[model samples]
Target: MLLEVKDLHASIGGKEILKGLSLTIKAGEVHAIMGPNGSGKSTLAQILAGREGYEVTAGSVRYNGVNLLDLEPEGRAQAGLFLGFQYPVEIPGVNNVYLLKAALNARQKAAGKPEIDAVSFMRLVKEKAALMEMDQSFLSRSVNEGFSGGEKKRNEIFQMAVLEPTLAILDETDSGLDIDALKVVANGVNLQRRDDRSVLLITHYQRLLDYIEPDYVHVLANGKIIHSGDKSLALQLEAEGYDALMAKAAG
Candidate 1:
């Protein structure tokens, strides 16, 4: 397994959100996590990304055979974990290009590789931007400052392209996007798919799945995965809704 969570338990603000959640993802697979509101979907993503304030009361998370919980946020990134936030942060004074360059170089340095020069970095940014249909001028703008919802999501995928993480976790990436923007974001994600890379898509709606089809879909409810199946499961959920799943779980 490329990633594994065993009997996972996590909480925030003294309230338990995830209780004994377990999951496993191997290389070259895409896993979609769909759930109703407050199902601990985002919390799972945050925990995997090493976000502070989420207390892990029990269980273990292993990535590439290393204890993922032991690593800090930066350490997790350097270890090839990337998370696309539901709400991308705005860095008022930071140029988007500069931020990407710095992040790429940092990851490279951590992996014992030489840093990419300005020329090579710019070339990469241009290529990735074109793939995402992003405007060239946007690279010079401040990081996510004043960006529209679609722009911010596309920018996040652009960063993912440059960083080339082994495992990418997208937390509600399709939430605020319109149909067109959703297609663009999904196209960008599809272009980045490789035989060795994996994606964990956390979403509430099944619309996003129409574009970026997953190998497996898991239904998360009450902080645990109540059901899991192939891509067909998503369509079923869309048709029958969470109430059906809830009723089934109750029985």
Candidate 2:
């Protein structure tokens, strides 16, 4: 398994959020986690990304057979774990290409590899930027500064593509995107799919799935996965709504 989250129970500020949530992702699999607001979907992503503040009261997370909970956020990144934030932050005065090059070099250095040459790094970034359909001017701008919502989301995927993480956890990446931007972002994700890469897409709407097409679809409710099925499950949820599934799970 690329990522295994077993019976995860977490809380924030003394309030329970994740309750016995178990999930597994193998190499090359795309898993879509859909849920209503406050369902702990984002919480699960946060915990997996090694974000602090939320306490992991119980359960274990194994990534590539290692204890993921023991690693720091940067450690996780160096180990090929990437998280695409719902809201990408802006870093003023930091060049986007420069930041990405530094991040890539850091990961390579941690793996005992030599830093990439400037010429090769530029070529890589330009290729990835083209894959994301981003203009060349974006490379000169500050990271995510003055970008629109859709642009930020695209940049997140762009970073993921350049880094080539073994596992990616995207939290509500399609939250505020238009149809055109959504297609562009989804295409970028689809093009980056590799046999050694796994994706965990946390989303609320099935429309994103229409473009990306997950191998597995899971419905998370009240901090638990109440249902799991194939891509058709997303269509079912879209047609019938989460109410019926939530009621059935509760019953």
Candidate 3:
């Protein structure tokens, strides 16, 4: 397994959100987590990313045989874990290209690799932007500053491409995107899929699954994955709604 979460429990400010949740993801696989509002779907992503204020009181998380809980956010990133936020943060006065270069350099240094210079780095940036159909001008702008919903999501994928993490977790990346933008973002994600990479997509709607085609779909409720199945489960949930699943979970 590339990623493992065993009986994980987490809370924020003394409010428990995840209770005894567990999951395992292997390389080359895509997993989609679906749930209704307030079902702790986002909490699991946040916990995996090592976001602040989410206290894990129980269970263990291992990434490639390393203790994930012991690593800080930056450590996780350096160890090849990427989390695409639902709301990409805008850092004023920081050019997107420069930010990406710095992030790449940080990871490289941690891995004892030589830093990529300007010329080589721009070559990579251009190649990835073209794959996503993003305009070159967007790279010169501040990180996600003044970007549209779709643009921000694409930017997140752009960062993922540059980072090339072993595991990527996307949190509601398709929430506000229209059909066109969603397709573009999904295209970028699909392009990054490889035999050695893994993706965990957290979403409330099935629209994204239509494009991304997850290998597994897990239904989460009240902090636990109450049900899990193949892609057909997502289609079934979209058709039948969560009421039946919720009832089954409660019973």
Candidate 4:
């Protein structure tokens, strides 16, 4: 298994968000999690990303054979875990190239590798940016500064491409994107799929699955995964509505 969550329970401000949730993702598998709002989908992603203030009241999460909860956020990133936030933050005054270099260098240092030289680094940046269809002018701008909703999501996928994480968790990345922008973001994600890479996509709609074609689809409700199936499950959810399935699970 590339990632495992066993009976995971998490709480914020004494309010429990995750209730004995369990999940597993094997290598090369794409798992899409669909749930309505407040289903703890984002909470699960945040816990895996090592976001602070969420208390893990019980259970465990293991990633690449290491105790994931033990590592800090940066440590997790250096270890090849990436989280694409639902809301990408803006960092004024930090150009994209500068930030990318810093992040890449940090990973290199963690792995006892030398920092990439400027020429080689720029070459790499250009290659990845082009892969995501990012314009050159966008690379010099402050990270996510003044970007539209779709552009921010595109930038997130661009970062994912550059980072090449072993496990990439995307939380509601399709929200607020128009069809054209959605296809662009989906294409970037599709290009990143590899036999050694795994993706955990948290989404509300089945449209993204039309492009990414996840190997597994899981339905989350009330902090627990109520059902699990293949890509067909997503279609079923889209057709039958979550009310019926969740009601079935609740029963």
What is the C-alpha local distance difference test score of each model? 0.95, 0.95, 0.94, 0.94
Clashes found in each candidate (C-alpha, N, C closer than 3 A): 0, 0, 0, 0
Q: Show model 4 residue runs off by greater than 4 Å.
A: none
Residue lDDT tens for model 4, 22-69: 999999999999998899999999999999999999999999999999
Against the true structure, candidate 1 reaches a TM-score of 0.99
Stretch of 10 with least lDDT, candidate 2: 97-106
Error of 2 at 43 (Å): 0.7
lDDT of 4: 0.94
Candidate 2's TM-score = 0.99
Candidate 2 residue-wise lDDT, 1-251, digit = tens: 88889999999999999999999999999999999999999999999999999999999999999999999998999999999999999999999998988899999999999999999999999999999999999989999999999999999999999999999999999999999999999999999988999999999999999999899999999999999999999999999999999999999
Clash pairs, candidate 1, are: none
Candidate 1 residue lDDT tens string, 1-251: 89999989999999999998999999999999999999999999999999999999999999999999999999999989999999999999999998888888888998899999888888999999999999999999999999999999999999999889999999999989999999999999999999899999999999999999999999999999999999999999999999999889879
For model 3, what is the C-alpha lDDT against the true structure? Answer: 0.94
**TM-score of each model, paired residue for residue:** 0.99, 0.99, 0.99, 0.99
Highest lDDT, which number?
A: 2
Q: Report the lDDT of model 2 for residue 239.
A: 95
Tell how far residue 108 is off in model 2, in angstroms: 0.8
Candidate 2, residue 62: Cα displacement in angstroms equals: 0.1
lDDT of 1: 0.95
